[model samples]
Target: MLLDHFDYEKLLVPLNLFYDLHTGGPRRPIFHDVAATRPELLELDRNFSAIREEVLNVLPERASIPRYHELDAMQTYISGTVDKDRDWKVFPLNLMGVKPKGFADRCPRTVAILDTIPGLFEAFFSILEGGKSIPAHEGPYRGYLRYHLGLVVPEENPPSIRLKDQVYTWKEGESILFDDSWDHEVYNSCTQDRVILIVDIRRPMPQPFDAVNRAAQAIMKPIYGGQIARKLATMTPPATDGDAPAMAEEKQTDDKEKASEELAKKLPDQADPVQEWGQREATGKAPATAGHSAHGDKKPDAPE
Candidate 1:
């Protein structure tokens, strides 16, 4: 994720040019000194180590069990098959509703940077050892992008990853943010363990409204449909009491009906029957009818 907001158009030219140059040719090395682009990579390494320690200390032992697996026929038959190696697995910590204690104080700067990027509410530092490789797979959600910040890079054997056709390696303290919607995979061929701070962030798209709408739909799908609609509707300012014309009209009709009833009781039994009928019709109490009553002479009571 970008720490500073920049003109994407201006940045895209260089990015596309670099991508084209690196990906087009017969696999050429695109490894640049991570220090060249970002000087703060060193600080990230220190912070990452501190946070990792905190996470390991704070998280329950049961939560630390590695969930990723290759394949199990019995488990797949019961719970459905999951490509353990292909999928990116991590224990998410520090979400809005599920923020852990001491998280904000321990990693304030890192969290602040991540907060700027949308859809990124949590993070995880993954431990990948020798011969561990994540197979090629796309992200489940389309709106968000993923980021990898390398903390510990093995000197002898470092982890390598390929995005689209361009292969790249991780450098200690350096970070790579990319759209996980694109096909990507990782390989750790080295003898030592490779540790990286894996961050997932909302994709920076041209149309933010569409992206937000889609995110909302995904989040609300599990709950009742009507309940979600009502929640979204509440986001809009409610109708003002002063602007309720319907209520005012109903009140006026009630007042008129009360006045008519009072007047009818005071008058003679058969006085102005047609006028009373007309008033009732006007108030929506009776249907319209072609009838007239003058001087108390009834026209067959106008069919009641």
Candidate 2:
């Protein structure tokens, strides 16, 4: 039934320049009511206290746990210590449809609980230290909804997330599901650390498209296993507000310039525009002026 409802067109249409030219906003739907749509997530939400207790027990020794992006400068925004802090650490169970034995062993309970959720693609514990501010960026795709269950939120002014204009604050045991493909940013303004169980859940889609998305994820399992996500996250430039227009315009201009250059290379070196125009005119087949062109105004021909 879920597969029958999946709209592949929504996923495909966003890539169209025409769609972007007309609608500059995100093409993906955002902030759907998770409780109504995914009751399984609410069941998982009930386990927050248990998960948080486990996290607290492990916190003392989590100092050795590597930061999510140890080699990335972006971690500086999360921990200030680009080379040192392990603040934005992650404990991943499943990644891009691939389950790591060690990770599953480490978080057996969480892994067991998540295994029952057909919607889940990747499951992990996300740690954010105080004062962290993740800049605005969209996910690589809109194939999944990011689910966050607040495990341990700081008491002092909790950090808030801004998904476009809507701002949300996490409370322990509460959960939110959002389309990460939309431009979003996070700020942990609290004095203490914040911890959330982050789940990348494959968005429910129509039959064929759902199958296609699942197959695609299956194919990408090796990449996740190989830590390609880490490599890509560090390598790709961060997307921010206003970047869409600038990047699109630059790309369009570059494409036009390249096309013009290619066309010039194919044209005769000795060709003259004036001579060509004169030759066409002599043949009574002159090209129409800009205003009279097919794309412009269609003028009625003279009476025979």
Minimal lDDT window, size 10, model 2: 293-302
TM-score of 2: 0.62
lDDT of 1 by residue, 172-240 (tens): 545665555456677767766566677654433444444553554344333322332233233322222
Task: Give the TM-score of each candidate.
Answer: 0.44, 0.62
Q: Cα RMSDs of all predictions?
A: 30.1, 27.5
| Candidate 2: Cα lDDT at 219 | 51
Clashing pairs in 1: none
Write one digit per residue (lDDT tens) for candidate 2, span 137-166.
766556677888777777679988888777
Against the true structure, candidate 1 has what lDDT? 0.45
- Number of backbone-clashing residue pairs for each candidate, in the order shown: 0, 5
lDDT of 2: 0.60
